[model samples]
Target: MAIHSPSLVELHAFLAVARVGSFRGAAEALHVTQAAVSRAVQRLEEQLGVDVFERSGAGVRLTPQGTALRRRTEKHVAALEAAALALRRPTERLRLRISVAPSFGTLWLLPRLPDFHAHHPEVALEFRQYHHEENFQREDVDLWIALKAQAHQRWPRQVAAEYLVGREIVAVCAPQRARGVASADQLLAQPLLYHSNYPDNWALWAEAAGSALPAQWRGTGFDLVLNLVEAARAGMGFAVVQRCMVEDDVAAGRLAMPVAACASTGRGYYLCRRRSLGAHPAVERFVDWLRLQCAGDRGA
Candidate 1:
């Protein structure tokens, strides 16, 4: 005799009941009426022509045939369920792993994340701070918010970089420190804080101000822009920094830009991604949003 093929619905109902050990429990698990579960199990057993389950006053137990069926079909059923879920929730596949420069993430991106999430809630994001000499190919990152000095800076093979924002330098100090300083010439005499990454920032800003630093001029050097900003805020010295790094502090009166002179280093942040992955929907969505944000920044 030919064996009858059971419907997927019947198999699902049977497995629910088998796993829960009761029709009522299965109904709860499957969010169906107890009668519906019972009908499905009855139809399934009739088609199979075997007692798949042994019923008792307490609940139910799987018979030898039911045990065999479950052993053979469990994994297949799980896979089918997962596929169905994936179909229903296509955004689950739109996860993005981004590597961001430490200063950029802390000073700019982090503050604006709420807006990003509000706009694109379906795209899942994971961020790790970008490290020096980090191998982009070896890392598990899907995108990078990397600092680049020039548009032509070389990236790993197959990686593409797009400019986001220029690193516009601003000379800042505490409000009290600015009081005694009437000119860039005078400000030059005060203590000057420095970021280790940009040793020539002071010289660049001074040149923009039509002045130059003394050959022996030096002060504290901080590796992190965050700490450098804090040192300036605390009146440790005058500091030069990328405007975005101190926008919030300046707005909140924690720091102040004391000079009208601004300088550019031909450096900026870039969005980097593998050329092959550029077609991903999540990548496209985020890149567009970020470009809009950068446009606003450039306008400012």
Candidate 2:
């Protein structure tokens, strides 16, 4: 039968004494008194029913048993320290990680953040410009807001979701780019930026405008609406983008309608997350506020 089973605190004391080889030294290392160190070591030895150290001529040496015990105790001691270190951190914070389309982050969310922050100062909002259909689990995210269809397809069925906006998608460009956009063919003659995921956007808008786009309307590619909008704003090309997401920029006289017609893309933004994450007060509050904001919007 074993002499004793050691408790973690006793092992801590044992490891300290065995490492330093002196009660006083162990006491200093442990930030404890010499008497406490002696008691701890005495308890360890008594529990084990073996001499762990040899004392002679102003120094100490470890017994064979002590050496073996040291090995075992060291591993446990390191594990204990690591576990303590992990627990020492604050695991919870009033923060939200929201991944969104690049254009929406810049043209919409960026402008409205101050309003959210003003209401909930404790909540820190972190907005990331992930692609609309990009998976969010790769990053440490608490919540995500993306075009609704993409969110539904990527996340599990258990996430509680709500639509945030039904935006009007229309072709927009700089005034110079919009100048000769009379017929679909003329409009199509100009370079058109195509979103990789939505290849048919330009075609759909052209159909809405009652003309087939010129064969070369598909001139360049853009991954996100913001890049397309930036290109259009700079007069490089024209691309279709969501109106609500670009309203502020449109109002600022930076972009103009490249075509008179707008198409209902049957898409909207959705607030999404695992149902469990909804329990967090900050997340819940943000969702509620977001829903209220959406309800007040005329487009929704």
* Candidate RMSDs in order: 18.7, 19.0
Query: Mind sharing the TM-score for model 1?
Result: 0.67
Q: Clashing pairs in model 2?
A: none
Candidate 2: deviation at residue 230, Å? Answer: 0.6
Tell me each candidate's TM-score.
0.67, 0.59
Model 2 misplaced regions, further than 4 Å: 1-93, 127-139, 148-155, 180-185, 292-300
- lDDT by residue (tens digit), candidate 2, 228-263: 778888888777777676666677778877556777
What are the lDDT figures for the candidates, one per model?
0.82, 0.71
Find the candidate with the highest TM-score and give its number: 1
lDDT of 1 by residue, 184-221 (tens): 88988999999887889999999999999989998889
RMSD of 1: 18.7
Model 1: lDDT equals: 0.82
Per-prediction tally of clashes? 0, 0
Candidate 2 whole-model C-alpha lDDT, 0 to 1: 0.71
What pairs collide in candidate 1?
none
